[model samples]
Target: MRILESDGSIVDIFAIYWFGDETYFYGMPKNYGGLQAYKADEVTVIDNKIDFKTVFFSNDDAKSVHHWALIEESLLDDLLELDETAYKRFLDILKSEGQLDDNFY
Candidate 1:
């Protein structure tokens, strides 16, 4: 997801997940394992206003999170170090994960 910042810059958010009372927001650059995990409470406010409980994705959504983590640990650093082949494989994995059809060649 893309968020428009207050400074008129566009930021890309890869994923967001919740665990217990915590909400994790992933939006860091690819080379840094951009996973930010935080807790949200009744007093927690965004845009300077309190909000109600936030619904989270189902348990199955964990698979996607796990996959991304694996990709980061296994490929992110290598790809950033100029490994073109690893980059290609990373793209393939992403395509496989996001593909809705069988044409993921």
Candidate 2:
């Protein structure tokens, strides 16, 4: 899977697979979130790019988790080709929101 940045850059190489009744988003645990059923359809491919609409949850303690409503592919290509700064920013955002998995990064 790939994440497209605002500048149309792609980075963060990952894979998507199905196991039993759930869809797993592998790689960089903090940036990964598993989806099931209807949520899995959120990630779609369009124009050879990927898009996502994410829903976030937070508590008074400032911890949060986000569930992305995958959208049609955008213009992003290789997930590993993203600018280093951008990738770090992405990871930071995920970490700050407590959305990152323990195994991420």
Worst 10 residues of 2 by lDDT: 69-78
Off by over 4 Å in 2: 1-26, 29-78, 101-105
Q: Estimate the TM-score of every prediction.
A: 0.32, 0.28
Model 1, 1-105: lDDT tens digits are 434444454333344556655655443233432333322232222332212122333664352243353344475455446566664575465556552123422
Clashes of 1: 0
* lDDT, residue 69, model 1: 32
Worst 10 contiguous positions by lDDT, candidate 1:
45-54
lDDT of each: 0.41, 0.37
TM-score of 1: 0.32
RMSD of each: 10.3, 14.6
